[model samples]
Target: MQQHLLRSTEENLTLKTLCRKFSNGALIIHENPVRQVGGKKNAPHLKTTAYHFDVLDVDWINTESSFEADFVLVTTLNPSVSAIYHQRATLTLSNGSTYTPDFLVIKNGRPTIVEVKPHKFTVKEPWSKLFEEALSICETVNVRFEVQTELQFRVGNLHKRAEYIAFCARLEFTSEDILLAIEEVSKYTDGMTFDFFMRITGLPKILILKLVASRHLYLNDALEYEDCSMIYSSPAY
Candidate 1:
């Protein structure tokens, strides 16, 4: 059997709970001060609300130099991820310095710390030191630590992931139609593409995309292609 790491102190306590507890108890949930360069914004700061099984409903993202928004989507779609919170956990170093991680994720009922940084900063002075400290702290708690960068999500065909998420948010999913669409689509052995399924069922494209977004329809390259062209399967059938 796979080993389970440290379970959370509370049965249903989430990382967001930790953030709230820290904020309420006056523990320094410290974050780097936002810096504006050249009197202009570096990049757009974006916030997205997750519709799936995440603990925190709203994810505030730093889209400037990091792909934090995409990471949020990735985590939301990941089955292993139970919950995710932004800038929620604080780790205090032996030197009396406190640092907040970019995300605190509950994966398979265990707490994991995720730090999202620019590739250029990964090997640099402060980030290197910070990551080391974060790793050590996580190790002490029997948790996993991960460092994320644009390389993970901004590759070719991956840039569209964030946009795809935005598009799916506009899609509609009526229960009866979605079920009928699934039942109709499952008749095909070769799997079904969104356009073909829509042509067959006369169902709207938005509802189809909604099923795909929820993973009720499974697609391997779902993130890489447009919704209409993507192929999918139903685990139910």
Candidate 2:
């Protein structure tokens, strides 16, 4: 009986390993972008801006518009967002029109196709119809579809803060600096103001912004960065 049980356990382990491999393969396949973003030389009409995201495997991701750029920045700061891709998928509508989404975001381990459009344009003709078709396609595939506007991305100077943080995050900083900042902030149970934290750490303002951008520290409810802004330690620590 003991010998039989050991053989069964070995077979189960092999099966589990194969299942894990299969799941990983499926995830990779799903994450692959259906269309590639073109550069200025290839597509003169489209304005491309390269954005950096540490969470994404690629060195840089390109955004076509300011709205898209803001979206990328804010999404990068979100702890729940694990991965992001630009122009990730192209879906065919029932009327034979193809629609390419602005972003493919992996948030909380689920895939969501997001379209960023101006508020005025969302209510207009062809765009409205196109969005409807895109929603249908996403629903069929069991993927989430969302339409984001400036209201969502530019909330109370959040985009401005995100952009500033992104720029500052590029500056040189060491792991020791980050650890020290976190340690100082963790000492305050209720958190502390940005100015107070800065005073205690003696780290440069840029490095503090870098910590916020990297999500090692968080901002106030509005996500604005200022002297009096409330700074909180990351719960992960």
Candidate 3:
């Protein structure tokens, strides 16, 4: 039998966080849980929010998952945990290695492949299959995935918006239903975009994809290479 023990207080949660842009244009702070996790190390900046989520254990987002608050602490990190990420390591893959995606996200009715990498080796690919999968998006748009920092993933707002929109539409909403959505979404349009949209919107993957595929909304240029990008349609001129 395997026994799980709590870490000692003196262990000191040390980690190196890297912020990378996702295919959806959201910045994510990434670190392996095996190496370290987020916590309080010292005094945090007045602007920092509390950290709530850990990497590695999260599942590949599926049909019933939420886009809201997947992670917490939008503004800043707790001081004590801030320096835990000081130890940085480079990723190395021998030739003929297999590349497995870290986490696959289904956004806007498609799969957005997300691969978390540290700051320095953000471009390193250990799996051979990844090279082709990463390159596969070169000609597509519906796919969204990339290396990112743990901090970026914490914002939780970018995916929120898209999720909200998707949720509203998934109800098979009519024009009348859109009115209710307007009331809800109107309160937070400051940082509205594809990434935030998916986060805050609380919508289903299919609805979000429909809106983008139809070009009713626009996404950041960074999303062009995402495999999920193909889900969006050409906008009506």
Clashing pairs in 1: none
Model 2 has an lDDT value of 0.70
lDDT (Cα, tens digit) per residue for candidate 1, span 94-129: 787776666777787676778877789999998898
Writing each residue's lDDT as its tens digit, candidate 2 over 1-237 gives 011111233323432332343243111122334444553255557656776566444445668778888888887888777666666566766766566678767677677789998889999998898888778767865778899998898988778878888888778878898888889888887988878877877877677788877778877646776788777888876
**Quick one: best TM-score, which candidate?**
2
RMSD in Å for model 3 = 16.5
TM-score on alpha carbons, each prediction? 0.65, 0.77, 0.26
lDDT of 2 at 68: 87
Selected candidate, larger lDDT, 1 vs 3: 1
| lDDT, residue 172, model 3 | 59
TM-score of 2: 0.77
Pairs that clash in candidate 2? none
lDDT of 3 by residue, 72-129 (tens): 2211111111222211222222343333343433232233344544334544554334
RMSD (Cα, Å) for all candidates, in order, is 8.4, 10.2, 16.5
What are the runs in model 3 whose C-alpha is more than 4 Å off?
1-92, 95-97, 103-113, 117-145, 175-214, 218-234
Please give the range of 10 consecutive residues that has the lowest summed lDDT in model 1: 30-39
